[model samples]
Target: MKFLEKKVKSMEPIFAKGGKLEKLHYVYDGLATFLFTPATTTKRGAHIRDGVDLKRTMFIVVMALVPALLFGMYNTGHWHMVAESGNMDLPYLNDFGAKLLYGLIKVLPMVVVSYAVGLGVEFIFCTIKGHPIHEGFLVSGMLIPLVMPVEVPLWMVAVATIFAVVIGKEVFGGTGMNILNVALTARAFLFFAYPTSMSGDKVWMGGQEADGFSGATFLGDAASLVSDSPTVDGATGLMDKFSAMDSFIGIIPGSIGETSVIACLIGAVILIATGVGSLRVMLSFALGGLGMGYLFNLIGPGLGNEYMQIPAYMHLLVGGFAFGAIFMATDPVTAAQTATGKIWYGVFGGMLAVMIRVLNPAYPEGVMLAILFMNVMAPLIDHYVVQVNINRRLKRLKTA
Candidate 1:
C-alpha cells in the first residue's frame, strides 16, 4: 500500500502544475482521488466528517443492484428461448448454463453501451470544465440499462445516455444538482421519442413469439384488456398465463432488471440497512400501490374496464412498480428529505403509478412517470413539512 501510494505521489509532480500534462490535471486528479481518499482536508471551520464517501456509497448501491442484474440476465435468456420455442411450459432454472450464457450475450452489450456513452459524456463535460468527474454516473450508468427492454438498439441506448448526461443531468450543473433521476431521464427520452421500439411484445424478447405465447409484458397485456374477461386470447387467462409465484420470482418477461420482486427487495434491504435509502418512501410507496389496486379491484369487472380487477399484490409485483419503489422513488437527491415528507412523496408516487397503469391505455408502465412527477413535487413536500414544524415550535414558544 505504501509503495503504491509512493508511486502515485511520485508521478503526481509531472501533472502538478507546470508539467507537460498539466492541461489534463482534472483527469489525473479525478483518477487519483477515486483510487484513494483526498489527502487534503479542511484546516478550519466546523464540519461533519463521515466514514464513507460518494464513491463508496455508489459502490454499495451498485452491489445492491447486482442480484437484479444477474436475475434479469438469466430471465432474458430464458424468455427468449421460450418465445422462440413457443413453449410456455418450459422448465425454469432449466439448462442453467445455456440460459445464463444467452442472457449475458444479450444484456452485456447494453450495459457496455450504457456506460461507454454516459461516461464518455461525463468525461467530455468534466474535461471542458477543467473539473474532476463526479461519481454520480457510477450508479446511473448501471441503472439506465436495467430499466430498458432487452432488444432496444445499442444506438438508441447511446443516444438516450447522451441525452441523459447532457440534457437530463449536466445541463442542470451535474450529478447532485439534477432534478430528475438520470437513468429514468434516459428511459423517458427513449419512451417519448421512439415509442414503437420500446413498446409491443417484440421488444421484451429478442426473437419472435410463438403462436400461443406472446412476449408482451404482463402490464402490456393487462392494459389491452377491454371486456370483463381475464383471458387475453381465449386460452389461459391473465392470471393463469402468469402465476403469482412467477411474477414474484420474475420468470415472466419485462424490463431487464425490474422483473424480479425478490431482487428488488434484496436491493431495498441493502439500501435501508446501509442508510443510503429511506424506508418511509419504499414502504409508503408499496402501500399506495396496493391501496390503489385494491380500490380498482373493489370496482369489480364492469363498465368495460377489466384491467381494474388485477389483484392488489399483482400491481406491486408486475411492471416496474417494485423496482421504482425501491430504487427510483428512493433517490436521495430527488426524494423528499423530511421524514414525514418522504411518506407523502412515496404514497402519491405509488398511487399515481398504479393509477396511470390502470387508467391509461396508451402507456402500460407508469412507474417512470410516477417517480418523475414526484421528483418535481419532492421539494414542495419538504417545504411544507419544514413549515409545519416551524409553526408548531413557534406556537409552543408563544404559549410558554
Candidate 2:
C-alpha cells in the first residue's frame, strides 16, 4: 500500500502544479475518468453506487466474444480444408490444429489492421480535440473483423475502418454519443462499397485458386431459394439443400464468426452469466426471429409461393443472426437500457431482420441491418418505457 501511495504521490506533483502542462495533464486525467470511471467513495446522503465501470463492462463484452472467436478460427480452417479436399464430412478432431492455424493466419491480420487504423484515427481526434482518448474502440475494433468475410482485402478493411471511425463515431462526437455501432458502420461501408467482395456466392470461402473452392452460405442458399430457379434438384427437400445440422454447427460459409450457432450461443451464455449483457433482449430477439420465420412458413403456401417456407430454426442459425444477437444487438451503449425497452428493441430488430432476409431478394444477410435499425430506435423505446414508469409514480402519488 505504501509503494502504491508513493507511486501515486510521485505522479501527483505533475498534475498538482498549475501550468499549461498541468492543465493538459488534468484534461488527460479527466478524459480518463470519462472513459473509465473509478469506483470511489460516495458522499453518503443518498448516493447510489455500483462496482462496475465502462472498462469493466467492455471487458465483459470482450470475454463474451471469445467463444465466437475460437469457433470462427476453427470454422475458417474447417471450410478452407473442405473446399480444398472436397470433403465436407471430415470431423473437427481429425485436423484441428492445422485448421486453427490457417484461420489464425487469415483472421489475425484483419484484427491488427482494424485496431491500428481505427485507434490511430481515434487518437488523432482526441489529441486534436485536446481530450483524452475514449477506449470504446478497443471493443469495436475486435468486433469489426469478426463480422467481416475472411477474404476481405486488407486495404478494404483499412478504408472501412477509417470511414466507420470518422463518420460513424467521430461525426457523432465519439463513443457514447454515436448513433450507430461503429463496427457495424464499418461493415455497412464494406457491404455497399464493395458488394462483390462483401457478398455473393464465392466470397466467404478463403484459399488460393489451387484450392478449387466454391462457397455456399446458409443465407446464400436462402437467397437462392428466392429465385425462380429451384435451389436444389426438384427431388431434394429444403433440408437437403442446406442441412439444419450444418447451420447449427457452422460448417457452411458466411461471415467469419457468424457461421457457428453453437459458438454464438456459448458466447451469449457467458455474456448473460457475467451480468454484462441483457438475457431478456437476446431471448426476445431469438423468439421474435423464430416467430417471423414460422409465420412466413405458414403463409408461403397461401401466398402461392414455395420460397417462403424456410424453417424458423434456419433463420436462427443462418447468416449473421446468431452473431448479431450475441454481439451487435446487445451493445449496451447503442441498445435499450431498461429491461422492458430491451425486449421491444430486440424483438423489433429480430423480426425486421427476418422480414428483410425473407422478403428482399437483394440482400442475403439481414442481421446487420436489423441491429442498425434497433440501435436507432433504442432511445425511442426507452423513452416510452420511462414515461410509463413516470405515469405509474404519479398514480401512486395521487393514491397516497
Each model's lDDT: 0.85, 0.78
TM-score of 1: 0.93
Q: Report how far residue 243 has shifted in candidate 2, in Å.
A: 2.2
**Residue-wise C-alpha lDDT for candidate 2, range 248-304, written one tens digit per residue:** 987778788888889888888888887776788888999999898888776665453
The clash number for model 2 is 0
Provide the TM-score for each candidate, comma-separated.
0.93, 0.85
By TM-score, who's the top model here? Answer: 1
| Tens-digit per-residue lDDT, 1-400, candidate 1 | 8888778878888877898787677677767877888875423211112556777788889998999999999998888888888887989878889989998998999999998888788878887897677778889999999999998999999999999999988898887788899999999999999998889888988655575667888878874533456422221367787878999999889989999999999999999998887899999999999999888777755445656767878889899998999988988888888899999999999999999988887886899999999999999999999999999999999999
Model 2 poorest 10 in a row by lDDT: 40-49
How high a TM-score does candidate 2 get? 0.85
